[model samples]
Target chain A: MMTTPSSITSNELNFLVYRYLQESGFTHAAFALGYEAGINKTSIDGNLIPPGALITFVQKGLHYVELEANLESEKFDGDDDFSFLQPLDLITKDVSELQ
Target chain B: MMTTPSSITSNELNFLVYRYLQESGFTHAAFALGYEAGINKTSIDGNLIPPGALITFVQKGLHYVELEANLESEKFDGDDDFSFLQPLDLITKDVSELQ
Candidate 1:
């Protein structure tokens, strides 16, 4: 059972992500645009990101996150990849309710 | 390169879930509570709920979702499990703003 923080609404966390990514003015838009139009074979959606799938983002080196929504890659702390998604927001409170 | 809806803040959607589940008073609290307390072996957190894990919820049939944050579960629409999570809220609009 997933628990939620009382102060931040989960919805707000997702919005923060959206606003941060889009408003950051740092969008890799051309690439992202191409990705959406199917010009790129790659995907960034959670459903598409399988477990253990490895992705390399240029200077970012090899990073791992479950890409296919499944955990296929064996668990190992010494693996060559420096990959992981930020933990999903656990805050349960509505952001507006915060002091 | 994930996409998001423009009108809805993801935060709001999460709140909708909280309101519905909590206010609705349909919590599987005992089971969920046990899972949370580490007094139970099962877990419901996204981190704990992997990509292709098979969970059998009583009378819910054998269901499959990636369980290990990795995609190890074979991809086939004909699988025997009746398991699936609701697609994460894809609403692009804030619920309050909705007409």
Candidate 2:
């Protein structure tokens, strides 16, 4: 069996934390960490994503997946991409509007 | 007070999980999450970091900070960067060799 690497570096760990914050849409937390760690290019498109943006982005993705699943294979375009280039619609709506 | 955002997206949550696993040096777990999420550029410098790496990394970083604190202010150049550009020395050694 292959043995695990005996050491891990701080840079690697910091990078992981950086990526995590960015992914979670914990914009404030991610920025705080990146600033402390002195890492460059830490933003997700240079925008401070709101806390709930991630959940909205995901629900919308699942909606699209379910929609695509209902379509016949022939009707589904294999080359079609479902990438969301912009923030979700929910992000644009106000909290009062959501209520 | 400003109201919090009304929704959080799934993509954001997935990113957070991926980041957590990666940051913790759970290489296998991080890859699994990344694969399921269809995220690209997920690896830390294209290598699978072993478990226990994050702990070691942090310990080493603390060692540096402590060392720096012991040095006199004038002796410690303000412009000096403490960046660790390569994997820590511990990583290069084998587990048995470490003992």
Which is the leading candidate under TM-score?
2
lDDT agreement with native, every candidate: 0.24, 0.39
Please report the candidate that would top lDDT against the real structure. Answer: 2
Cα displacement (Å) at residue A82, model 2: 20
lDDT of 2 by residue, B1-99 (tens): 112232334554454445555665556546655665655644222233333333432443333222223232225455343333222332232223222
lDDT of candidate 1 over A12-81, digit per residue (tens): 2222222232342324422232233332332234343222111011001101122211122223223444
Task: For each of the candidates, give the backbone clash count.
Answer: 48, 9
Query: Per-residue lDDT for A11 in model 1?
Result: 35
**Model 1 Cα lDDT, one tens digit per residue, B1-99:** 222121222332223222232332424422232233233332324343222111111001101121211123223333444233331221221212221
Query: Candidate 2 falls in which docking quality class?
Result: incorrect
Please give the interface root mean square deviation for model 2, in Å. 17.0
